[model samples]
Target chain A: MPLSTQSQAEEEQYVLVANLDNARNLSNILKAIGFKDHAIFTATPNGLKVTVEDSKCVQANAFIQADIFQKFTIKEDLVALQVNLTVLLDCLNIFGGSTVAGISTALRMCYRGYGYPLTLFLEEGGVVTVCKINTEEPEEPIDFDFCSSNVTNKVILQSESLKEAFSELDMTSEVLQITMSPSQPYFRLSTFGNSGSAHYDYSKDSDMMELFRCNETQTNRYKMSLLKPSTKALALSCKVSVRTDSRGFLSLQYLVRNDDGQICFVEFFCCPDVEVDEDL
Target chain B: MQCVVTGGNVKVLAKAVHSLSRIGDELYVEPQEDGLALRSVNSSRSAYACFLFAPLFFSRYSIDRGLDFRCKLAVKSVQTVFRSVATLEKTVEKCHVELDKAKDRLTFTLHCKHGLLKTHNLSYQDTESLQAVFDKDSCANVFRAQSRVLVETVVHFPPSVEEVTVAVSSERMWVRNHVEDEAERSKALLTELCLAADEFDHFAVGAPNSITFCLKELRGLLVFAESTGLPVSVYFHEPGSPVVFSVTDSVLEGNFVLATLSDDHNLQKSDSGGGHAEPPPPPPDDFMNDDIDSYLIAMDTSVVPGPSTAPPSAASRASPAADSRTRKHSEEEEEEERDGNEDPGRPPSKKFRSLFFGSVLPPSPQTSTQPVTTQEVLASDSEDEDE
Candidate 1:
């Protein structure tokens, strides 16, 4: 409440500022895509977006819509800055991120523009702490150019099913092959590990499958290590949409519901692993 | 060979594979007339375990007659297929295991809920089944203790403890960990526990003896026993012979054989700080005197008394525990008296090897402290062949 009482002139100095009654709302979603260290933060009037990339082969984006925050303001048309995700998470959870019901940490995040540090004021149980994380030049995120119209195969399933499938995925396998088709063997996940090959299939009419649309059957292979981190998002989400473009690029969008029952989105885009026998 | 485990038994099969994985890197699966046998032997060849799954354990079972079906597969490969036993129990309805001779591979198919079918095909190598020759019925010392008793005692030992000595007498039994060599004493963490002989369901001690074995295999046994809520039956001879632990049910039986260490006896007479050349009690009645081949315990006196007086004590062990006791008692009555005075556990009435208790730092009484009795034989002998 004290943060909101700050003089309007002082608040105007910050090009971007947002406040939430519960810091976990921001910290939890950030954690969904916190697998990488350097995260590019883009603040626009719509909300805040955090993007993390790995080996230029995979990209993860976490979006926090404007309405979710208790107070949101943006003086600039677009503000992009990069910061260490691990450090930011540590500062946000400095109070240990109490999970007790009705106990929440108040967070006020502010950025003064380029060449300035991102300041965070966190309060828990009436005790206030401040943190200033230095920002670095933002790097452009790779655009997989995987649009909705180009999607050849798509399936929506409850998180429970995918969670079981992913948790048991063979880590020894170098790549995971996914087959999505309209007819027989509707959707399948296969892995070729040291011991042998394993396959898990899902019929279209299964109770867990919420939606299934396939214009053409597509089989693509993705690096297991690249897609492994997305299990964190899958664990927190309630529903997930899996799609593959005609180019064999993969996209996984998770509908994550935060602790406050507010909906948020985290999406992952990964380029397929090329087989040795396949001509370039 | 082909077998089908309908619903109920799939979980048991998975757990058996998991237990075999802990024993060795390779799994030897043998198909026989009566059932299927899964076996594994540690790389050091010191520990070997086998599980026999009867035909009743599987709903549908068949194997070609007069043909060898013994094949070895990487334990990890098969273990991966059965990973997550808890999940498998709930989702899987039936599991089929079939051997494909043409393809030279083994396939595991699981039919689960919601029309979901999962299949795994593992390639295996043809090999001879490793069989350990030991008579479980003739073991001198045998006892059946509840898994709870073993687990409670093992929990007191820190993970750093690699070996544990099981010392048993007619009246009492004890467990301890600490190598007696002075060089290893600084790093050796001392732990001792005394378990009453009555704690077991059945207890028998033909000869008061001590056997030191690795905890790694014991842990593997505990995993199987605790899960099935079955007591583990231990049968072993003297310190040098292999110890066999068995768990059984109406449909399944598992046997684990672990090699006992002989150097623990050597670790005894080699005591550095006992001050007196404690050749142990002159009488061999209470101490472990192996009539069988166990020269290490009998040969270590030379290494210990190398710089000290009484170099002949090294050659004394060559005479066996019985013959050596008479020789030592006559040769060093005075030294044995000093050892009896320093150690409260080692009474002259019992000729047991107090090799370890003699060096035991005054029982500090740990929160879970169990005393290292003179009769305990400091079973903490570590396996020299652990490598």
Candidate 2:
């Protein structure tokens, strides 16, 4: 139709373009890391990374590889811009976000370099809506600098097992204490709530645990409020990788598979609430 | 009063309590030998819901020695305890409800399998009974339709629609969103649905009638009706009367009373005028077109138990043609005054006073001094003045 022809003619002026047959593929992942309003979008030839941070202590990143998109094109080496993630998601799913099979909203996202609004064209059935959301100067996202080599302890477990414990975690607790060791009490999640202290232990040899590598015992406490938003990613993921570095910086990596079975990754990095006394 | 409910019956009770909680914060529970009655009225007094569960619906029903056991409990407390009825249906063996009259608290004890018991004590307040008495024979129109059809049709209308106008005649019954904004009216695109007389289980119309009522409350009542998988019976006298929606199965009967909107005919008239020319003259004797004094009387008698004593004053005041004409003229003047105060392109101001009163004008003067019959003379007076 005329709309398709017009989009083709208008696509040449943009530095970056991405298209998805199902807009939910993008909206769902954005919702996973949607802990804050402003999201710093950094796009490269490899893929797209959306970063959201809270209080500079917790940072979340959602990675969508280039192959996941039906069509991904970039004329520049790097493109970065910041926009309201909530509004962007709302615009992406403007067609009521129906999950019925055989019905999907097609999306064509275009960004014209510097000072221009991030333009999105969403169409379902025959109706088309074009939304131009104003972009802001991208803020520098905090670098948690949590490297695998510096990781002192790591464990990968099935998301289903952790989901049960997360769902029942007492919110009255100020902090969630994680203890990983080579000896007994192998992996533990402890919460001291108003009612009482609760400990959820997972044996290192359990079927749900995929990998467990601990050289020495490590105990770290993370603010419950900071780690609460990661539950969204956990709920959508099939497996999760929990890692703690020497400095006690915690990282949670979730492997999420969308409706089409295409794989994506969402990572959350949270700073420890307190430095543990080694004597304990 | 003490009762035990189990299985699917508890789920139904929970749904009813949840629906009543939407109407009012406080729910009045009245237990009688026949059954139990749950009633609530909205704070605005614009909407009311009454649910009656027959004794057969409960597994074991008993009442303390008294005329009737009545108490008011906070709706939120009840709703929280019964939030997940589906879970209760599977896990709960039986639920026993007891009214501790001495302590002024109602206790609910739930017994589950494996000897698990949970009890919730809900404090209640001392409140007067809620009684809405309306003569069913006085209603001129009655129709019964499947709840599914009504709910599916209402879904087509936009969410902004506050009121819906239902027009029923011998031929067919149709509903249309009552849009009051001039700008929205200009679009000429409205959600309208019509159902043939055959679609209704029973359709009887003494006279062609049109009524307007709030759509939000109707939607809520329709949800309750659909949950029961029963047809809804609607009864109304005329335009400015309370529209009653009744749903009844073998075990339960629910009646939802919503006050029809006044001055809705004015909205239709102005809409048809296409925003050009002044509104057509108000219907001469439509009780709503009367002076504020008589209008208040008409409103008051519809709710309170004073229909016999209140109508004489309305009839006497409505007798003088000169006074009625002046009042009608002044009402029109006041409407224009309101119109002038609003933004030019805005639709006519809403009849907030009439809406707040929720008064239904008695259909005929023979029923209540035949107050409307005098409007014919008043119409002629205004026509002469116009010439």
Candidate 3:
């Protein structure tokens, strides 16, 4: 269904419009970045980007390209608004076909100018549920400026492999240490938990490693609590790219495949937790 | 002390761990001369479940011969390693577990299909095993069937059902939600299923008997049995006796013993006993935990709706020979003897209530106590006074 088919009189009132045959394709990817309640929705001609931040330390951005949806339209050049992501997700799954097949909830999302509620038109099995979630003032997201040129070490691995590591991670540990080197242990994840210190090392030549590029031996620690939310994205992704900048800032890009087989991306940028005194 | 379970057995071990987690918060991992013993008892101490994975069950099994090896880890922590059995069966090639004396921690390392290794080091403390004593051979009423039959049957009953009654005569076995009395006949949601004795693979009833036991632990055991592709066998005597559900796989054996109600205990609170007296105190709660047993002994006798006053089955505490015979099952486990269990036998004599409870009867010395007959013991166990 396209916006042209709907009442143009009513559509003219909305500054932003997006439509999907199945709400799950949009909601599933949104759930990956929904660790927090507040989400900033940024719309451009290219696509819709949803950003969620935690404590100003970790920020997750999910990019849903304009092509992933059946109809994507924006009256203005840049339309940005903030709303409770948890509420949006609940509305998306209101029809409850997130997992079931043959029953899909068609979603039509619309937004007016500032301060207007974000209206959702969801239909499943001929029944419709309209949810109007209130919107809030959009806040500026932090910019890490972590470009590829500044990335000291980067590794792209099959999410299947990283999912195993993250699922079994010792949650008791306050921080997760990542080590990447050109020498012996090519990649490692270490945690010092209540029981003891456990390290998982993945050799550079391992089959699960899609690409491994390391120039210097770099080790950095990130708060496990901040990095933990990325596990949800890792579980839904097919491949995950892990990169650490020279300043110990970490960037994770997950390639998530929607139910329609279209490609989407969810990325996380995290600042270092602590620098241990290990000169000895 | 360490053991390695490889190939398909890893999933079985994980399944065993998952099953034990359902029973208790803590798991007692004891390595015996026979095999590895994992046991758990519920909080109220009404149900006890054990899995004895024989040496053959593991690809590599070894223990420190000189030092005593007994430690307990939180079941929740151990479960994180074996979170999903269906997935573990596919991705996990082998699971190596170790208890390093120097480290003093229980470590489980799972080697996955992609040469991925995940290790979980869980802190554990040295603890005593919770052992339950129940006589399966002496139980005149026995029922055996495929695991799915019971699993499917259990699904029909609502989850709120706390106690379930299985009544057996020579011909029929009636399984129904335990109804306290005729007054609740209309308002209560009752579900009943009747299976002929002949329907079971093996069924025998030497004497007419009915046992009302907690249904939570039984459902857990049945699901475990059904998943492991093993048949379940049930054996028990009259009410108040611990009903044992035994599942034996190729190299693994599990016994789930549940507490049952005696049906005859008349409540004095006049509250309609409306709450339906909490079955019986776990027969095994006495010897399983010393604190609970002694506390039970310390409780006022009349406050508890004792199993019975002078109905029948009461074994004498004076006979040691009968004691050994009744404890023949758990004797191999060598469960440490606890206080007040002078002679623990349920042989229906003056010994009364000794099977499920240690006899601390007859507060006969204290005049401050009520003047009731000595037939009723404290907490769930009742004995018949000498006629």
Using TM-score as the measure, the top candidate is 1
DockQ per candidate = 0.55, 0.02, 0.32
CAPRI quality level assigned to candidate 3 from its DockQ score: acceptable
In order of lDDT, best first, we have 1, 3, 2
Q: Comparing candidate 2 with candidate 3, which one achieves the higher TM-score? A: 3
Model 1: lDDT of residue B50: 86
- Expressed as tens digits, the lDDT of each residue in B9-54 for candidate 1 is 8987888788888777888788878799898865434567888999
Lowest-sum lDDT 10-residue window in model 2 chain A: A1-10
- Candidate 2: tens digits of C-alpha lDDT, residues B237-309: 6654567888899989888877665444535643442222222243444345444332221222122221123
A1-280 in candidate 1: lDDT tens per residue? 6666768888889999999999999999899899999999999999999999999999999999999999899998899999999999999999999999988889999999999999999988888888999999999988899899999999999988888789878888899898899987789898888777888888888888999998777778999999999999999999999999989999999999998799999999999998435411
Clashing residue pairs, candidate 1? B165-B379, B286-B352, B287-B351, B287-B352, B302-B314, B345-B374
State each model's C-alpha RMSD to the native: 12.5, 14.6, 10.5
In terms of docking quality, how is candidate 2 classified? incorrect
Clashing pairs in 3: B283-B356, B314-B348, B314-B349, B315-B347, B315-B348, B315-B351, B316-B351
In the range A1-280, model 3's lDDT, one tens digit per residue, is 3323578789999998999998999999999998999999999989999999999899999999999988898999989999999989999988765576777889899999799999999888777778999999999888878888999999999998888788878898899999889885788888887656667778788899999999898889999999999999999999999999899899999999988899999999999987866720
lDDT of candidate 2 over A1-280, digit per residue (tens):
2235555667899999998888999999999999899999999999899999999999999999999988899999999999999999999889999999999998888999989999998989989999999998999999999989999989999997788668767677899989989886778787765433446667788778899998778899999999999999999999999999999899999999999999999999999997767522
Worst 10 residues of 2 chain B by lDDT: B378-387
